[model samples]
Target: SRSLFVKNLNFRTSDENLKKHFTEKLNEGRVQSAKVKKHLKNGKNVSMGFGFIELDSVETATKVCKDLQGTILDGHALILQHCHAKSDDKVSNRADKDKSSTKLIVRNVAFEATEKDLRQLFSPFGQVKSLRLPMKLGNHRGFAFVEFVTKQEAQNALQQLSSVHLYGRHLVLERAKEGETLEDLRARTAAQFTDEQNGYQNSTKLAKKRKHMDILDKPDVMFEKIAR
Candidate 1:
């Protein structure tokens, strides 16, 4: 396929921006077309934070995948992979079965890390099917669950990211417990809410002090409220 799946895009990234990043910034090759997927939400078009790019040839797509797999753009790392051909229905069916074991529990995430960051961190191993960074009281709980499109991809991420660091903290990656889903993890974490209340007063004080500090304006704030 001459198409490449581009994931972990910034929400504000546009189709033209995506094309320019590849053609101008990276200088990879001519982009035939670039599109950032968007959907109507609350009567507004919102970026789905992923996109597709069509290059000149399969060779160009392969080169792009190799050279730009983890390139950062607009503060979000890009994940590039060759799009799978949909000609074989049997292969597609087989892929559906592979989803059973694709979930991973990511531990020790920096509470300041956003979904985009986690997606950028994991999408290089494979297409991320979905990701969840559970939040409580307007703050992330310092972990996430990521599901890749295939079990092998999930395993690859687990192995590669186990020793990786984000925001100066080492990451702990493990396969999701047998038959564990994101909802189950959410429930488990929710059960621990009472334990986290001990720090709630401190977090609240810090939040109040920093209320005027715009996280949107200064993206470098490192103080993250630990869930427990």
Candidate 2:
């Protein structure tokens, strides 16, 4: 199963289009199949803007990846990283990477604090672009990310929130680098929907297109709005 893990795909790109483009780029018929991650909407498959391409062999896959990895396909940046082997199934999808951003990390979060509480706390500084608080067994992981529309807003919020108490816990703040890569984020979004379907969430152990051959095993889901 030699494949290329592609990311940052445009929403309009279809499976047939992916196969055709890769076949042309690689100048061969080694592409066995191409699939875009999809979401289930009233039983319909909605595009989730990321997918994979299967080639005939690892050498062909590697050569195709090398030839097309960073090339713009259908007007979007394509990050063609190597696909992991089936034996690597235990690797968590949330493992950290080097991508950086201006999102501030708020730690020591109150176990019961909600998104509203976080928005209220940071709103005075500026528009809160986005926020994410991971949970496990219905309890906050004691940390979250609050992204401001501007760096100054994030800085201001961090300063004001440095010592504030919420849910009876002092907030610890820091910056996030690139939060999550667009490709990984899409895969993460799909993995979250799959977790919700499975009625479990580890935040750190979510599967990424792993064991996706079955409908029950891999849910087709789009990224949810990052609002509460």
Candidate 3:
């Protein structure tokens, strides 16, 4: 069957309706079959407003596509393109290792995993200087880079925890590469503004400091408060 992938259909369009409508437009009995894509949501199959139209020949399919592409129905514009033909054989294949950072790249993390949880996972190896997860403007990419205080500690973590499962997915661990800087990683991944943007020199500067009216905006003013 020569099929055309279609999009932006009216939500209520059905399998028979799809074929019937296109068959009418083509003015021929060339439409062989039709299937509307559906979504399973909350125990119901919802129309996805897209589907496939199979024709008797590729020539007929192309003709219908050119004739009806962008035809509007219920204010939704239609998009039409040829569907990928199935090959006789079905096969599947799937496929990391890294470099000089006091850091390790951890992969296959669940989206819900957090920085604190990751810290606890490697804390026994050594003090983690910092941890960074690669993000696309605040979205988790399901991987992270952790910086131990020393390269030796990072190597240790890599040796021990490589291919281990955390949160039900096996992890791929390795030393981070040169390009993955902690500041840039965290700043880009963070949901809020970075410390530099807030006028602070860096995160370390405000990490911890005892406030004693010395916390006032004027840098030199002070009323030293002692712990009583």
C-alpha RMSD of each candidate structure in angstroms: 12.9, 22.7, 16.5
Model 2 pairs whose backbones collide? 39-220, 100-177, 100-178, 101-177, 101-178
User: After superposition, which runs of candidate 2 have C-alpha atoms over 4 Å from their true positions?
Assistant: 41-44, 85-228
The model with the greater TM-score, 1 or 3, is 1
Clashes of 2: 5
lDDT of 1: 0.74
**Per-model C-alpha lDDT, please?**
0.74, 0.64, 0.65
- Could you give candidate 3's per-residue lDDT for residues 85-149 as a string of tens digits? 22232211100122235666676777766787687666655568878766666877777878776
RMSD to native, candidate 2? 22.7
> Which structure among the candidates has the greatest TM-score?
1
Q: Ten-residue segment with the worst summed lDDT in candidate 2?
A: 89-98
lDDT of 1 by residue, 142-228 (tens): 888888887666766675455455665677876766666789866765565556765797799888778756655555553443322
Candidate that would win on lDDT? 1
Model 2, 146-216: lDDT tens digits are 76655555655665456555544667886654656434443454464466656654432445334444444
Residue pairs clashing, model 3: none
